[model samples]
Target chain A: MTEEHDHSGNPPQPDEDRLAATEFEILERALRELLIEKGVFTADDIRIAVEAMDRKDPANGSKVVAHAWVDDAYRARLLDDSKAAIEELGIDVGPAPNLVVLENTATLQHVVVCTLCSCYPRTLLGMPPSWYKSREYRGRVVVEPRAVLREFGTELADDVEIKVVDSTADMRYLVLPARPDGTDGLSEAELADLVTRDSLIGVTQPNAPSGG
Target chain B: MSDQEVAPAFTAGQHVQVKTGDPPGHIRTPTFLRGKSGVIEQLHGVYRNPEDLAFGGQGFPKMPLYLVRFSQTEVWDNYDGSPKDSVLADIYQHWLEPGAE
Candidate 1:
């Protein structure tokens, strides 16, 4: 994860947001209680679902990118059929809301944003960064992507094209950033180490290995 | 839901126009891209309509979703990025119609 991915650095949610969060929590609890009482689903099942979400993080996406960087076959599969490719690596991305992988090539760059709302691939990348859900990002990224990338300290050359993918509904996109130069000798683990959560989101490119 | 009933109406590389007119209730199509023309980059298979899913409806009659690509120049008149640059968005079949070349 990069500096931008550090949720610890994020400012505390505002009073209204906090209140909304509490309201949602209470509603969720009430619904769960009702469901349980109606014999729809057990509390234990809800707990397991919560735990599964907790277990997911950027590492899942990093591993997938690292594998693609090292293995052409896997990369082909990923681009051709992302859900199946990811599942081949033993990560089931649930049944609904399909997942799509976008590759960043030398001539093209990919960025992900949800303009309508904060619809993200939570199962694969854990919770999105606070900034990701902010109205500023959602509103601007689609209209002024280069400027937004500049704000994130990413400056691209004029020749490199940028493609902003708006995760509007059922589809979730993960950016497969171009492998940095001078990483030819790096192992898959080492390559994954260089890939950051921000890179997966396409805010910035992967950090090149130091002193390689 | 399996896509056995309806064959996908569009294919990758085919042109499409995002339909205009707002339907009340939860919608996945963003206003910015509505009535815009773009090319279908990929077919995302069949899935239950999320608009129906949002409201507790069964989200029935699976529809083919697509990754649509529109040039920055096409979507916005004053887009700051390179004209070659484009954007991709996931849109449902209902929101798209065949586009003029």
Candidate 2:
């Protein structure tokens, strides 16, 4: 949705027409060809990397959270060294930004937003949702966190403290939402199904599984 | 920015103020945080300078990044949240200076 365009009353181009190779696309093709010619990287390598990126999704983060909830040892490791902890589960965040996990407790809540740009834990959560990248969210979350959270239907008690984290540097954050009650008997995979992308982002808490 | 791994000048629990300036080109420091004071929550380790990396540089001299915490009331004059509410920002070393205790 972020684009540069002239506001001179020109009708918006159709999707098909716009997809038909614009100047930037042509330039990109030329540049890729040049890079391949210079032996910087191979076309096959690019293809594999793109495919791998596409495979990343919030389910990866859910698995980590689920394990943390059931295993106290893993929970401590996750908070102390998140990158290495995730690697133990075969999730590689190579070339992605460093990651940190923030724990949410009964008296504390954690929320994350990148006010400068939509910098997220892409390797864990995949592509960020449109709402996370909107100007409206970036501009207001830091100044009015409670109101913004209310809009997300997350009303917290006044006694609970809210902590809004602005991820602006070389690191990305994940909120380790408190484990929902009655989930102690569930297996790791079953618990993962209860976690959602919103909970990891701290906008909402994970829903309790049915028949728990 | 050199590629040297310099040690961080500040430490956790130290009060610091975000340096005020409008440097152009590929900056991560948000405008609203400039000149604001906060306490360092943790040292998040030395990493590549995003400002330099954005302009195609090697992102060297890897500066220390800190998690700084500011109270809701300190950041906004009319904050509607509970007094326990606080905001944390990940800021690079160069953007911060010592603050009054």
Candidate 3:
């Protein structure tokens, strides 16, 4: 006879099948097909765009951060004209919204959110994480940023000022996290490894240099 | 409409308050910021008004957008964070008026 394991601790879970497509998904499919039919663009064009977007990741932003940490002039240029500085690294920002780099100082911190919608620097950091686009994050981060940062395991001294930037229009912000302590000897490539996606978002600081 | 014909109504370091209203259609101004006071942080040049563009109209006479900085204490009554904490948002010219510093 087949043996049935005890089910006390483990409840029956739902099947792992894909759910039906959402209304928005259906609408998007319909719109895509209509646009292709009208010769706006071919299916191949859409596929290529999607693939390109998928390839963009936080490493691009990490490289920018690492370079800024090592070079004072690049940091200045990044703060003054972020788009040009970013492009100087051979990174294409495309026709995205103007990029603004907010420098985190000893006495101040910066965090970013999109209260209106999910506006992000996709070309530099890939698509935003699911939480970045969630209603709770979009709503709470602006009002209680410190608390939100705490939830992300980031704690700041009371004296440090927190600046929350709400991307409401044609501008996207990238946080330039302060370089971690005792990494003066690290190379630019090593520094880039320390930068994290959360650091770029200002939710947390960069990871400490390994073994130091 | 041309942006060249009209200059921006506000400039950096100017104090302004967001216009409060519940007008219909594609408004980018956050409701929490309405009637709140802030200082202009930077001018982001002119752009087509999203409100107009939402309905397929040419967002002409592009409006000047500025990054407005608002204190968290002033924005929220029970702001538990430090008084030094502040929030910044990109605001359009049409949604602002002179405010007391």
Off by over 4 Å in 3: A1-23, B1-6
Q: Which model, 2 or 3, shows the larger lDDT?
A: 3
Better of 1 and 2 by TM-score: 2
lDDT by residue (A97-157, candidate 1, tens digit) is 6778899988899999999889888878888999999999999888889999999899999
Q: Model 3, range A127-184, lDDT digits (tens) per residue?
A: 9999999999999998889889999999999999999999999899999999999899
lDDT for model 1 comes to 0.89
Model 1 TM-score, 2 decimals: 0.87
Candidate with more favorable, higher DockQ: 1 or 2: 1
Model 2 regions lying over 4 Å from their true place: A1-13, A16-29, A37-44, B1-3
| For model 1 chain A, the run of ten residues with the poorest summed lDDT | A12-21
Top-TM-score structure, candidate number: 3
lDDT of 2: 0.90
List CA RMSD, all candidates: 5.9, 5.0, 3.1
Error of 2 at A90 (Å): 1.9
For DockQ, the strongest prediction is 3
List clashing residue pairs in candidate 2: B2-B61
Q: Kindly list the per-residue Cα lDDT of model 2 for residues A1-212, writing each as its tens digit.
A: 74467657887666685566888988999999999999999999899988998889999999999999989999999999999999999987777788999999888999999999999999888889999999999888888887888899888888989999999888899999999988878899999999999999998989887982
Looking at model 3, the pairs that clash are none
